[model samples]
Each structure stands twice: as C-alpha cells, then as structure tokens.
Target: MRVCLIASGSKGNAVYLQSGESRILVDAGFAARELSRRLELIGVEAQSLDAVFVSHEHGDHCRGLGPLARRYQLPVYMNPETFQALPSLGRVADLHHFDTGSAFTCRDLHVETIPLTHDAARPVAYVVETREGRIGIATDLGIATRLVRERLKGCRVLILEANHDETMLRDGPYPWPLKHRIRGNHGHLSNGDCADLLGDLLWDGLETVFLAHMSETNNRAELALECVQRVLEKQNLCRPQIVVGRQSESSICVSL
Candidate 1:
C-alpha cells in the first residue's frame, strides 16, 4: 500500500492512495485542473483513479468533487448528509452513499467510516485496510473522539490533523467569533490537541505520521512538529517518520 498527500492546508486538500490495482483519492478540494496537476507531480494519472471518498462538504474538502468525478467518470462515496450538502455534485454519474459507522469495500481496499466531530453535515474520517497494513485518515475534525482513536489504532501510516497552534490562534489576526469557532469543540484541532491524541494512539506498529491540514495563519509546520515531538519525548517513545503536509506540493509517497 502507498499513500501520498497530494496537498493539505486551508487552501485545499487531497490525498492519493494506491493498493494493488486500486487507486483512490480521499478528497479533491482543489479545482479539477489543480488536482490533475498535483497528481501528475506524484506520477499518478488523474484518469486512473477508481473512486473518490469525501470526508465532508466544506469547499476546502469537496470543491472539486463535481467536476473531477464527472470528468473522470469516477464513483464518489460519502454519507447521505454529506451528499445532500454537496448539491453541486448531484450530477455525478456514480454517486454512492454509505452510512456513517459502516464498513465498505472499494475494489481491493476495505474502508471503515468513522464519524467525525466537525461543523458540517455528517463529517467522517476513513480507516482503510490494505494487504500491507492499515492506513487511517482523520482530518477536518474538531476533537478526536475515543472512537476516532480506537479506529486509528494499529495503523501503519496515520494522516492526522494538526490544524493550529493555540497561542498563534489566539494572537492571530482573525476576528473574535472566528477564533472562538476555530477553538470550539466543533472546530479544527489545535497542535496541543493533536499531540494529546497521538499520545494515546501511538503503538509499536505505527511507523509514519503525517501532520496534515495546518492553518496558514494559525499554525507553522515547525511548531506542529515540535509539539508532537515534545509529547513523544515526554513519553519516551520512539519517534516515527513524521512528515508535514504542505499546501503547495505532494508529500513523499510512503509505502508499507
């Protein structure tokens, strides 16, 4: 199994995954052209994607779903509420709806949808199992629930969200209400929150950790990395290969 963070940030987000003959995209937040360009950067052809699994209806998560799915004639999978929220994607020819907390198969990949806490219509995170190992994707989430931690356990590669730094968020330029929303239980996770969650989820088999969906204004990659590293150090845990996902380029493709 292979995983590549094609792009991740407030601007847009997408993840590419390949297992055996199956190729899938977890999100297509960028425009169709931009998604194609990013996939090309990673040596993947856009037309070769088998399907797209949406995590939510937010523009930064599903903005390109309509055009991208239609252009490639790809099937899109998401919960009914998310599908309803994305009215623009109604024209997609092969839209498939699955309930949250359900497990489904997409070609060679086995996917389990874990419900997420976010200010969106039925947001979800995915735990994908391949022959090599399990890969968990938990982003665009507020608090990491116990279920999220349990579902993500034993993953060989974990793509987790470290959206903001608490101090930077409080001191940043955003207005009071926006800041409150971001710090609220239904908002994105802070670096501290991410670190705390990782402390509980870490296990011997977890080899790679990708810190994703960082805020351009409220978080710096170095700060996010430092926070997680501090937690690991305090626990006297062996550090994994931690990679920070950037908005402009693809992360190194990690294979298991």
Candidate 2:
C-alpha cells in the first residue's frame, strides 16, 4: 500500500492511498487544480482515483469534492446527512450514501467506517483493506470511541489526529466559547488523548503513524511527538514512527 498525505489541517485535509490498481482518496478538501498538482508530484493522476470517500460535510474536508468529481467523473461516497448538508455540489456525477458505521466497497478496496464524535451530522473514520496491509484513517475526532478502537486496533498503518495541546488550547488566544467547545466531549482530541489511544493498540515496531490535522495555530510537531512518545515508553510499546502531515505540501509517498 502507498500512503501519501497531500494536505492536513483545520484549513484543509486530503490523503491519497493506493494499492495495486486501487486508487482511493480519503478527502478532497482542496480545489481541483491543487489536488491535481499534488497528485502529479506523487506520480499519480487525478483521473486514476477509483473513488473519493468523504468524512464529513465540513468545507475543509469536502470543499474541492465538487470540482474534482466533476472533472474526473469519479464516484463520491458519504453518509446521508452529510450529503444533504453539502452546498449544492454542482459537478458530481455520482454520489453514494453509506451509514456512518457500515462497511462498503469500491472497485478493489474494502472500507469499514467508524463513527466520529464531532458536531457534524454523522462523520466517520475509515479502516481500509489493501493487499499489503490494513490502513486506518481517523481525523477531526473529539474523544476516542470504542468503535474507533475496535476498527483501528490492528491497522498496519494509521493516519490519526493530533490536533492540539490541551493546555495550549485552554490558555490560548481562542475565545471563551471556542475554547470550551474545543475541550468538550465533541470537540477535537488533544495530543494527550492521542497518546492514550496509542497506548491501547498492539502495534508492531515502527508502526507508521501520521499525526494529521494538527492545529497550526495551537500545536507544534515536537510537542505532539513528545506527548505520544512518553506514553509509548511507559507501556513498553514500540514508539511508532511518526510523521506530522503538513497542511500545504504533499509528503513523500510511503509504502507498507
């Protein structure tokens, strides 16, 4: 399986995962042009994508879906409420609706959805099966859930959220209401939450973990790494090799 994080953050997020003839995009948050350039940089063409699986209706996750789907005539998938919430996406040729916690398939890939704890209408994370190994993509989450733990328990590669530092978020520049929401049960998960979750996984050595959707305004890469590494050390678990995905540049394609 080849995993490439094209962009990740609060502003926008997208990841490209491909195995054999199956090319799947987790989110299409950028414009068609930007997505095209990023894919080309990683040696893929937009038209080659078999399907686009959307996580939520948030603009940062599905902003570019309309244009990209229209351009490539690609099939798009999302839950019913999210699909209805989307601003009249004018360019979509096909739209498939799946329940938030259901399993679905597209071409040569198998996807099992894990419900998310966000304010959006029925968001989900996906556990994808490829020939090489299983990959789990979880982001924009608030607190970790039992469903999420079950889905991600055995993933060979994980792209999960490490969106903020709890203290920083509590004492940062965000207004009072926003801060309360962020630290609530349905807001984003802090770095500490990520560490706690990682401690539960029976991960093999150097298990690839892409810390994605980091809050640029509220978190730092080194700090995020430190938080997660400490927990792994305590549990005598292998410190999963971690890479922070950026919100702008496309990262090197990694294979498992």
Candidate 3:
C-alpha cells in the first residue's frame, strides 16, 4: 500500500491511497485543477483515481468532490446522509452508498468504515485493508471512541487528527465561542487528546503515524510531535516514524 497526504489543515484536506490495482482519494477538498496539480507533484494523475470516499459534507473536505469526480468519472463512496448533504455536488456519474459501519471492497482493497464524532451530517473514517496491511485514516473527529480504537487497531499506518493545542487554543486570537466549539466533543481533537489516544493504540507493528488536521492559528507541528513522542517515551515503547502533515504541500509518499 502507498499513501500520501495531498493537503491537511483547516484550509482543505485530501489523502491519496493506492493498493494493488486500486487508487483512490479519501477527500477532494481543493478545486479540481488544484487537486490535479497536487497529484502531479506526487506523480499521480487525478484521472488515474478510480474512486473517492467522502468523510462528510464540510466544505474543507468535499469542495472539489463534484468537479473532480465528474471530470474523472470516478465512483464516489459515502454514506447516504453525506451524499444527501452534498446537494451542491450536482451530478456525479457513479455513486456508491455504504453504511457507516459496513465493510466494502474497492477493487483490490477492503475498506471498513466507522462513524466519526463530528458536527457534520454524517462523518466517517476509513480503514483500508491492503495485502501488505491496513492503513487507517481518521480526521476531523472530535474524540476517539472505543469503536474507533477497535477499528483502527492493528493498522500499520495511521493518519490521526491533532487539531489543536489546548493552551494555544485558549490563548489564541480566536473568539471564545469558536474556541469552545473547537474544544467541544463534536469539534476537534487537541494535541493532548491526540497523544492520549495514540498511547492507547501504540504497538510494535505500527510503522508510521501522520499527525494531521492541525490548526494554523492554535498549534505547531513541533508541539504535536513532541506531545505524542513524550507519551510514547514515558511508556518506554518503540516510537514509530511520526510525520507532521503540512497544509501547503504533499507529504512524502509512504509505501508498505
């Protein structure tokens, strides 16, 4: 399996995943042209994508879904609620609606979907099971539930949300209500939240961790990495290669 984060931040979010003969995008946040450029940066053509899996209807997660899926004639997979929420997506040639907790196959990959704790109409996360191993993608989630931990267990690669630092969020320039919303159970995860959750999920087979969905105004990459590392060090566990996903550029392609 191969994975790359095309973009990760408040501005937009997209992830590229390829396994066997399957190539798919988890989200298409940027415009079609911008998504194409980013894919080109990683030597992946947008037209080569076979399918798209949407997490929710948030603009930052699905803004480019309509244009990209239409232009590429890609099959889109999402829960029925999320599809209904995307009336703005206009007409898509192919659509597949999978139940939130069901597992489905996309060509050579087996994808398991789990509902996420977010304010969207119906948000979800994905665990892609490849021949090599499983790759878990869970972002825009407010908290990691038992079901999430269960679904994500045994994954070789994890893309988890590290949305903000609690102190930074409290002291940052954003107003109180917005801050409260972000700190809410249906909002986003803090750095501390991410670290604690990761500590519970750490294991020997975990090869790489991508700290994703960071807040530009309230969190730093160094802080997110340090927090997770500290938690692992205290437990004397072997640390995985942790990479911070950047908002402006594609991540180094990871293969397993």
Candidate 4:
C-alpha cells in the first residue's frame, strides 16, 4: 500500500492511495489543472486514477470533483446526501452512492466508510484495506467519536486531522462565530484533541502518521508535530514516523 498526501490544509485537500492494481483518490479539492500538476509531482497521472471517494461537500474537499470526473470519466462514490448537496456537480458520467458506515470494494481495495461529525450534509471517513494492512484517511472531523476510534484501530497508516492550536484559535483574528464553530463539536479538531486521539489509536503495528488538514492561520506545522511527538514520547509502545501534510505541496509518499 502506498499513500501520498497530494495537498492538505484549508486551501485544498487531496490524497492519493495505491494498493495492488488499484489507484484511488480520496478527494479532489483543487481545480483540475492544479490537481494534475500535484499528481505529476508525486509521479501519478490524473488519467490513471480508478476512482474518487468524497468525504463531504466542502469546497476544499470537492471543488474539483465535477471537472475531474467529467474529464476523466471516473467513478465517484459518496453517500446520497453528499451527492445531493453537490448539485453543481452536474452529470458525472459514473456515480456510486453508498450509505455511510457501509463497505464497498473499488477494484483491489476494500473500503469501509465511517460517519463523521462535521458541518457537511453527510461527512464520512474511509478505512481502506490493503494487502499490507489498513490505511485510515480521516480528517475534517470535530470530535474523535467512539466509532472512529474503533474503526481506526490497527491501521498501519493513519491520515488524521490536527487542524489548529486551541490558544491560537481563541486569540486568532477570525470573528467570534467562526471561531466558536471551529471549536464546536462539529468543527475541526485542535492539536490537543488530535494528540489525545492519537494516544488512543497507537499500537505496535502503527507505522506511519500523517497530521493532516492543518490551519494555516491558527496553527504551524511544527506545533502540530511537536504536540503529537510529546504524546508519543510519553509512551514507548508506538513510535511511528510522523509526516505533516502541507497545503502547498505533496507529502513524502509512505509505501508499506
């Protein structure tokens, strides 16, 4: 299994996953042209993707979905509510709708969709089963629910959210309502929240961790990494390589 975070952060978010003979994308946030360029940076071609799985209807997660699918004629999988929320995505040639919490196969990969607490109509997170093990792609979630913890257990690679720093968010330049929403139960996770959740999901086989979906305004990549590193240092059980996902470029590809 190989995973590359093509782009991450509030500006746009996309992930590339390849397992066996299957090459899939978790989201298509950037415009088709920019997305293509980022894929090329990671040595992946937009035309080579087998399918795209959407986690929600947020622009940073699905802005390029319409053009990408239309141009490439790719299969798009999302829950019915999310499909409905994306009315602007007119006539994607192939559409596969699955209920949240359902499991589906995309060629060589088996994907288990888990419901997420977010502002979108129907957000979801994916756990893809590969020959090497499982790769969990979960971000944009506010609270790490019990179901998320259970489903993400034993994953070899985890792309988790560490969106912001609590103090920075409280004192940031954003308005009150926006700040409150971001700190709410259905908003993005803070660095402290991410570390707490990571402590719960640690295991002997957890080889890699990607701290994704960071806030460019309220949080720095170094702060996010240090927060998680502190948690890892407290315990000697799990010591996975941590990679911070960036909005401007692709992360180092993790092949397991």
TM-score of 2: 0.96
Backbone clashes in model 4, listed as residue pairs: none
Identify the runs in model 1 with alpha carbons over 4 angstroms from their true place: none
Model 2 lDDT tens row, 16-133:
9998878989999888899999899999999998889999888899889998998899999998888888866775778898988889988778889999998888888999987777
TM, every model = 0.98, 0.96, 0.98, 0.99
**Per-residue alpha-carbon lDDT of candidate 4 for residues 1-256, written as tens digits (9 for 90 to 100):** 8999999999999999998899899999999899999999889889999999999999999999999999999999999999999989889989999989999988988899999999999899999998899999999997899999999998999999999999999999999999999999999999999999999999999999999999999999888988999999988795999999999989999999
* CA shift of 192, model 2, Å: 0.3
**lDDT for 75 (candidate 2):** 93
Alpha carbon RMSD to native, model 4: 0.7
Task: In model 4, state the lDDT of residue 13.
Answer: 97
Candidate 2: which stretches are off by over 4 Å?
none
lDDT of 1 by residue, 129-215 (tens): 999999999998888999998888988899999999999999999999999999998999999999998998787788899999999
Q: State the lDDT at 210 in candidate 1.
A: 95
Winner by lDDT between candidate 3 and candidate 1 = 3
